[model samples]
Target: MIRIVLIGLWICAVALGTLFFTVKSHMPASGDAGEKASYLGGIDYATTDVFSVPIMTDGSVAGYIIAQLIYTVDIKMKARITVPLEYFVKDEIFRQFYGSYSDTKQVEKVDFERVRKSAIDGINRHFPEPVVRDLLVEQFTFMPSSEIREMNMKSIGKRLSEH
Candidate 1:
């Protein structure tokens, strides 16, 4: 039993060492590549800053969704642009978001997955060829209207000053 345990431990150590050696500096920042790929498989990936998506009600802004997005594709993805492809993707992101008319229509509830799919579809339509394999919403925040922020700030400020 002791000898078997020792051999098992040795095998684990060797496996771990090999994994670290192979992945070091090669693993991209995020996501699961599984046995098929690394993060984007070391392919070109684009990310966006937090998008303040306005939620409209009664023809006015009701709330906002702070969304950060990621676009991942295979290493073969290419583009013809003077600016970094990320920036170009960023511009297209907003265009696709607003083009859905979500800001104009009163969206009482937000389905993030639905929004993500719509955005992807819109972007693909804008592009003659599909460029992104997947659209990942890394961060999604639902912020209340500006009126709420001011009221909250004032309440906090009043309490802070009292103390």
Candidate 2:
């Protein structure tokens, strides 16, 4: 048993070392390639919790849009801002979805590029210098109210069967 355990540990160490070296070899060198690398050290990302917006049509809740956003900011400049960055991102996402619903009368189609542009522009408007570098949409999903009701009904049925 002891010998087997020692062999397993050695194998794990070798695997880890191989993985590390492989990743290191593929990493961009600090030269011309470094210039093209988007994630240099000076930038930091702020991720927002999931935001949900109820789409309204004809004075009733038509569906729901769920989104998660990430915003990149300059690390040095982030400290100067008083309010948290996530708040602005969440507000912008909500506005984008809400505004789109109003303009198109449905949330089936989304212009992701427009959302990103508006988010960066909207947040930057408050500050003299542009603080938000870019906006990233990690998750964006839509579910109709009827599907939600169906899901709820199924869940209720399952719970009742369990009891």
The numbered model that scores best in TM-score is 2
lDDT of 2 at 23: 100
lDDT of 1 by residue, 74-126 (tens): 45445443345455555655554443544533343557677667666765554
Worst 10 residues of 2 by lDDT: 97-106
Q: Which 10-residue window of candidate 1 scores lowest in summed lDDT?
A: 99-108
lDDT of 1 at 160: 100
Error of 2 at 1 (Å): 38
Tens-digit lDDT track of model 2 for 1-163: 9999999999999999999999999898888777667556668888889889888776777888888888899877798988898888887777766635652235667778877898899988888888899888888888888899999999999999999
TM-score of each: 0.54, 0.71
Every model's Cα RMSD, please? Answer: 9.4, 6.8
TM-score of 1: 0.54
**Whose lDDT is greatest here?**
2
